[model samples]
Target: MKFLEELQSLKEQIKRRVQFDVPEGTKNIVIGGMGGSGIVGKIFQEMYTKMPVYTSDSYDIPDFVGDGTLFIAISYSGNTEETISSLSYAKKKGAKTIGISSGGIIEKEADVFVNVPGGLQPRSAIGYMLMPLLLSFNVVSEKDVDYAYSLLKRIDENNIKDEDIAKKIWETRRIPVIYGIPGYRSVAYRWKTQFNENAKVIAYSNFFPELNHNDTMALRDTYRKNEFFFISISGGKDSRSEKRIDITKEITKTEMEEVVAEGSSQFEKMIGLVHRGDYVTYHLAKLRGVDPTDISSIEELKRRLSKE
Candidate 1:
């Protein structure tokens, strides 16, 4: 399937195939997975800020994870070694465990299982992997999910103009440095990873106020000016962040791009920014003449790891 088709699959993927409930008396949540699957956890942690949510991309469960912790293991392929290993540790630790996967030992071992649709690349199945988990937490309403689908449908229908500019910047072979505020930091990370996996290009990401203290210092190095393209994902919620972006632009004056999000609510802003970035990454992939869906380098690394 084409990358866009996989992204569009979210229209049908929101229907949950397996159902699970968080146990009562759970005090905290810990999510474990790796790579594309792992990103779902990170996004969730950012979106559901009311609770103590931690994401682990490593092989072992964190020391803080225990019986009171609700551990969610997410692996679209159902066989990510790090996630499986973490799930095993969670079970041994007596944490309440839920597994989200297509199918694998995780499904068999989890106290409860969520079956996401198979066939699409894990990253491309963001809605499938993320929506169900968010629903479980009650952080995302059905209306929110519906709105996201409708928003994507509109974007698909209305040609994205940002694609042309993004293609031009990407074709220059300059490294992409994505920045955003607290509300849109995850979106920036998503853009960076999308470029990494889809465009097969190296990209970096950081949040505002924090980046101002250290990363802004790099602007003094004029030799690196032409080597980087600065892209900011602005949620447009904070005056401080807006000022920071303005200052950064004034300081560097490099080839900069801003993906300003429009929405009345934080959730809407986040999904909107993510939707835009996804399309930009697709265009970047097209300009590079690479299959956006293919991540052979990651597969090769996994193969090497399996042999070790």
Candidate 2:
């Protein structure tokens, strides 16, 4: 299926899927996965700040994880070694565990199981993975899901414009360095990964305030400007972050291009920016004459690792 068609199907899947309840007395939440499966937790961690939410991409679970922790193991294929290892460790530590996948060992072992649809690329199934996870914690309402669906539908309608702009920005040889304010860091990171996986290009991401302290200084060297294409993603309400973004733009005026996200709510901005970036990566793939859906290197790495 086409990427846009897969995205369009996401909300309908969410609407039909069953919801799980967060266990009572849960104090902390830890999500374990990698690649597309892992990024969902980072997005949630940014949105839900009242309690501690950690995303573990490594094999080892944090020392603080215990019975009070609600550990979520997410792997679309149900066989990601790192997430499975972390989930096993979490279970041994007596943490309440929920597993999200189509079918795998996690489905059998987890205290609660969330079954997402199989077949689509894990990255393309973000809505399927994210909405159910958020709904379980009551972080998002059904109305919010409906609103997001509407927004995505609108984005689909205007995707040609987004694609035209993306085609213009295609730089087959230059590395893409994406930057965002703290609030839009995850979105920027998503864009970076899309370029990496979809366009088969090297990309990197960093956030503001922190980047201003260190990375901003590197932009002074005009020698490297032609080698990199900088893209700054801005969608923050914080005055300090906003100011830093503005100043950083001035500092890198000759080196970087800017893209601002638009939306009234945090969810809208996050998903909206992601929707646009997805198209950009798609167009970038077209410009480079590469198949956007192919990830041969990753598959090769997985095959090699499986032998060990």
Candidate 3:
């Protein structure tokens, strides 16, 4: 319920204005973090296309991430080890470092610290995690943001379509394969993780043009064909990608659930689609008789890693 309720706070989260100045001579951007925190970078990369933006999930900084690079570390907990390690690497390379977190070691280590609200699960804080990037980059216009927020604010938290999708996925008892177009690739990944963590089920995601070439062939394996469920997310205005999705469906002849993204702008469409998946995962957890908030396996892995 807490996670579900937090979805409504996205309007407030986007209202946060960040004060960040791009350093003189900064040529590129590298965002470092893992899981939920890192996912924001993926979303930002799609939104901000002015320059090259790279997202790193591992401990090592890329060799080119030096001098003119601006490194931003995002860790909702402020204590994620890999982010700290990457931050250290960026510093050694003479890159300017900024960290966004509720408060943790990153607060002290980063040259610039952005403190967001804490206490909620990292996955549940997407709005808080995403605001810093969105506000700083100005990739989205103020008018578009306001329009998107207004649209999102009016969403029915208990959407019946989302509930029906969840029920269909839960009843299928098959591994889910979610596909997205170029624009919605991050959303597909988010849905996969939501199912893995929230629904406690194995889920996979891939994008259209690329997957149509390779992954679609995997569907031909008759032995395992019936063991998977496919879902396609549609919304991006790319006509070529849309045709690819349609052709893939016809060629594969595999049953796929289509989820149309709702909203006027790209920002709103992405947020609304992600919100839809969040509710679907919540309902799926209920149907699966699992606690959506439970992430004991991840916690256990973190605990064991801390000991090493």
Candidate 4:
């Protein structure tokens, strides 16, 4: 519970700590990473898939990547083997590269870099990976990453403060079920992963309209009022699915403590709401007293599976 308070304070802590510049001539960006680092690319996929943004977890670069490509090698620990190998591959391919990490191998020789100060788990540092990604694009004007930052800046979650809500929802051991609209699916997934990695707890998510038919039936089977129902709201001005999500949350108030998303624009509000969830889940990790920075179990599993 105390950790939630710490995480809420952390958003401001790292917000200004890691700002940087995107060099000119940067085009066709490619992010190399996996697991937690890779989620940054997935969020970008959902948000800015329009650009030539590619996320590779392997050692090889895509054929389309070349000197014109802006390669971003991200490995929070500064020693991710796959990412290091990929960056080496990217460099050989003549891509302009940058390293995003907490001063790992990627940072050692990256053309440009932004360091994350989080001691929490890599998965919990999604905001750090996320915000920096947005800033890089906004710096180069490829995406409205700056618009997203401004949206995050304007976020007013005072009504949904993590302290009051954390005491009620995440203080105990309860699996969280994150709900969001179609457009905000990425945000929902972020919440789920933060709960799992940082909070070190089980969590799940389902989108609106689609969940109405399937997830609604299993709602009662979830088996506890202790679990929190996070509602990631995206004001869908161009789509009706967002409104469906709002209604779904209203109808399901009987199931759990609901935290709604808030923002003026869809992109702004979606990212803003996600930021709060990020803080909440990371604190949840701390409340449970996990390092939030380690994932040895995941690494072991990956290692075991790779042999197969």
TM-score versus the correct structure, for each prediction? 0.94, 0.93, 0.96, 0.67
lDDT (Cα, tens digit) per residue for candidate 3, span 118-157: 8788987888888778878877678867877776676644
How do the residues 187-284 of candidate 1 rate in per-residue lDDT, one tens digit apiece? 88988998899888888999887987888777656877788888888878578888888877888664468778876566667777777777778888
* Residue 215 in candidate 4, Cα distance off native in Å: 6.3
- Residue 54, model 1, lDDT: 90
Q: Which ten residues in a row have the lowest lDDT in candidate 1?
A: 10-19
Off by over 4 Å in 3: none
- Pull out the clashing pairs in model 3: none
Cα lDDT, model 4, residue 284: 61
lDDT of each: 0.81, 0.80, 0.85, 0.66
Query: Local error of candidate 1 at 259, Å?
Result: 0.3
The positional error of residue 296 in candidate 2, measured at the CA in angstroms, is 2.0
Candidate with the larger TM-score of 2 and 3: 3
Superposed Cα deviation of residue 288, candidate 2 (Å): 1.2
Report the Cα lDDT for residue 258, model 4: 45
What TM-score does candidate 4 get on C-alpha atoms? 0.67
